[model samples]
Target: MKLRKLITVAMACIMVFSLAACGSENTQEDAAATETTTEENKAEEVEETAEALSGTVVITGSTSVEKILTDMIDEFTALNPDVTIEYTGNGSSAGIKDTKAGINNIGASSREVKDEEKEDTLAEEVFAYDGIAAIVNPANEVQDITMQQLSDIYTGKITNWSEIGGADAEIFIVSREESSGTRSAFEELTGVAEAGGLTSSAAVSEGNGPVQAAVAGNENAIGYVSFSFIDDTVKALKVDGVEPTAELAKAGEYKLSRPFLFVYYEDKATDAGLAFLEFALSEEGQICVEDHDAITVD
Candidate 1:
């Protein structure tokens, strides 16, 4: 009887130990499951935060660059509804100055930053190439002109449209205002040297539209503007029989064409700016430009 009782006690102890082992294993499995759940919740939160990018960025300057920003606003807002853009066309010089003062997130410039500019707060990106075309009233009937002829007209060297194969009318030269990048480009090509160097004889206007308007409204008037600015209201004079199309400009066949620039403060660049620039340089941005009758870098 004693032996039998002893054996029974041993078996009972073994069963209790086995039960304890199983309980411990179940607890370990439950703890592992809880840990995995906690990790998954944290991952979901990070994903949510990354998707929520929002802010306002402002850009101002060259009216020539306004179209690109117009295109960007539509597409960028569509992709990121939380972001907003505000822009203005105060001319390229105004834009550059505003960026330096930190009043604007970006500045638009057709001419590169000149060495004489007081501040060095700009970082630049090449956006597109612009062909500055010499325009005259459609009724003027001027067919062709060389670079020399253009310079002569602006310097009062050649006053009559007839000298360049047009009607027998005095050339009404409409020029760009001092702050205009178009003026800078015109001066560079015509050897006026700087903004104020235009001869006293040529008439001056404030913006591209005014230049076009001045020329279009007056049969004897002539001025220059970007190829994109040419419309039915004015005529685009041929330079050496080569038209100012984007393809011709890209090949450097158009003599007066120059690169356009998008400028910003280096310190003002945010994550949004980096992403937006990348998008603009990508296939999508190029496609937007092509659709809007503007040139792309490809």
Candidate 2:
């Protein structure tokens, strides 16, 4: 009978230990679930905070940067649907002036801002680098031209195609308009920024597209345009034995290159403007720069 009682007590102790083990397991499981819930809640809060940021951003600047910036803006707006962005492709100098006058939220320039053009209130952020391609008609037999030869041809010093190993036809110089950012960059890089640098007789187009079309349609025409615009329509010449490309530009091997800048007035920047700038300088925006065939700052 004592043995029977002892056996019953042992069974009771076993039940108590089993219950304690089960309870401990349940407590650990509950703690794990709580941690997972806390992490999920934090994630949801971050998503909500990102979605809450919404506003309008206005950008005005160089037509040279218009295409890339437009693509970036489209991507950025897809995430921040309520954030509005408007871009105007005025000349770079005009954009800078407008930004200074509070007419624009941000100013885009294909070239670095000149010291004389910058104000104490303004800040320059270079987002990308662009290579200026010297283009010619696809039919042109000229495969390469030195930088000095290009400068001479544009300046009317070398007016004949035969002077650069092509046919004996007269070289038609197609140039961008005076206010074009491409023109400013081209002139500066080619050492033609001095007075009467570009030939007054050259056919002047207003935008990069027009310049490309003009060169593409004329067999004897030579022009310079943004590297992104060069395709089968025109042949890009090797300057000083190096082809103008984004990689060469980034490596400083391409001479006809310039920075793509975002100029803003720090004091005048709004919350939307600041957010947009952050997005532009982000990795995603840099990817857009590469997608557009320009070199990212990084």
Candidate 3:
């Protein structure tokens, strides 16, 4: 009876060990399956990113550039169908301020960094070359003028179309407001001292389109805007015997030419910001520049 009892005890112990081994195998299989599922989930997330784009891109500054971006956005949207672009016609200074404060994703500037504004960790990328033009109403007989004359008119030294050339009418010195990037660029070219001061007898408008419209609407009006803004309604005058043109501007023959740049946070190298900026500089994007009546770098 003792031997039989021992035999039963041994058999029971063997059964327990066999059950534990089976349980271990099942646990290992479950862990492997779980790992495979986790990997699949990670792959699905990547595929989703590849399949669709969804984000709002805010670009602000240089109404002149904004003109081009509006059309670019139309084309970009057609291709992307998922990304949305929003642009504002704020001046370069205002745009840069917004960029620094994290209010805007991209800031369009017509010139390089200023002394104080350079303190931020933002990055700048030049996408196009821009030349500014002296715009006059199409009805005005004066087709061309010199930098000296333009400076004189802007400084309130010359106040009539007759003072320069055209009809004997009061020349409304229409211009962008003091906060304008275009104005800053003009000031840099003509020498601020020659321009008198920010407070001149000129009529300052809120934005570039207004400046363009004001000149186009009034027969005796004169203003300065980007060469791109010179359309059928207004005439672009020469500066120092040089026309504000792409070719002339590139050779430095055009004195008022400047670079159109895109400003962003310094991390632009590794963000969606890089993609848009790359597109802006791409061959296809450069082609779109003319759609808005502007010149492209390439």
Candidate 4:
């Protein structure tokens, strides 16, 4: 009887060990399966997001915002190759109209949305800030200008370059079309809007590129353009003794800055449209903005 009892105890012990070993193995297998499932789910989520973001997004708006937008688009598309973005350099007013009418997925603007343009369905995001630089040909010696002086120049009061300490020549005024957001913002900032708008005789360019080109080729011409558009061919004048740099604009030391906006109809925007808009506001997108000489929204 003692032998039988010892044998029974040994067998019971063996059975217990076998059960524990099996449980341990099963637990490890379960853990591995769970980890694999988690990884697969994460991948699926990423794939879904990418899939949803694949579509065409049409953007139209201010010529002032075009260069920065292009830079942002290049960065954004690198991360999302499946997305397509088309941009047209129409005036800000046309952009607003297109966005409002659902003709475009997004509208770019260098000016604030006017009260008359606001609606419940329409939404706008400030993607960046830009300074309107009063540019002159590099050959011109005018280095700085006061707001009052700029106002006078645009209003046809200061027609002679000598009136503002520059060389003796008739100031050839280069102005933007009435629908241009840059023009609206520049005029408002310089108090030219209140002084009866840009002078009627000023040569009007339809886009920033044209304005820059006209100024770059004419030594007597003076025009304003987005800071992003400034290049070696043109010299940007200091406004009110403050240099028009992104740093100064962000610090509020430069007074000629305005908001760069993305306008869209909230309810009608495509997934890709919303995604692109958010991307432009993201930290990475802001880096692209700064890289192109525009200030980030932050």
The candidate maximizing TM-score is: 4
For every candidate, C-alpha RMSD to the true structure in Å: 8.0, 3.1, 11.3, 2.7
The collision pairs in model 3 are none
Q: State the lDDT of candidate 1 residue by residue for 1-298, as single tens digits.
A: 9999999999999999999999999989889988999999899886674476568778788876666668877787787777777888887889888888777887778777777764565678876767788898888778678877777777777888778777788888888877788778877876666323667878877778878889889999889987777899999988778886778878878777766677886667766665666667778777766664556775
lDDT of 3 at 75: 67
Clashes of each: 0, 0, 0, 0
Using lDDT as the yardstick, the better of models 1 and 2 is 2
lDDT of 2 by residue, 96-186 (tens): 8888888999999888788888678789898888999999999999999987887788788899999989999999999987767888888
Question: Judged by lDDT, which candidate is best?
Answer: 4
Of the candidates numbered 3 and 4, which has the greater lDDT value? 4
Question: Sorted on TM-score, highest at the top, how do the candidates line up?
Answer: 4, 2, 1, 3
Stretches off by above 4 angstroms in model 4 are 1-29
Summarize candidate 4's per-residue lDDT along 1-298 as a digit string, tens digits.
9999999999999999999999999999999999999999999999999977888899988999887888889988888999999999889998999988888999988899999999987888998999999999999999999999999999999899999898999999999998899999999999999998888879999998999999999999999999988999999999999999999999999999999998888778888888888889899889888887888877
For each candidate in turn, the TM-score is 0.78, 0.87, 0.77, 0.90
lDDT of each: 0.77, 0.88, 0.78, 0.92
Greater-lDDT candidate between 2 and 3: 2
lDDT digits (tens) for residues 169-274 of candidate 3? 9888887776578888887787654556543567888877788899999998888888777789888887777767877877778888777888888664334455
Candidates by lDDT, descending order: 4, 2, 3, 1
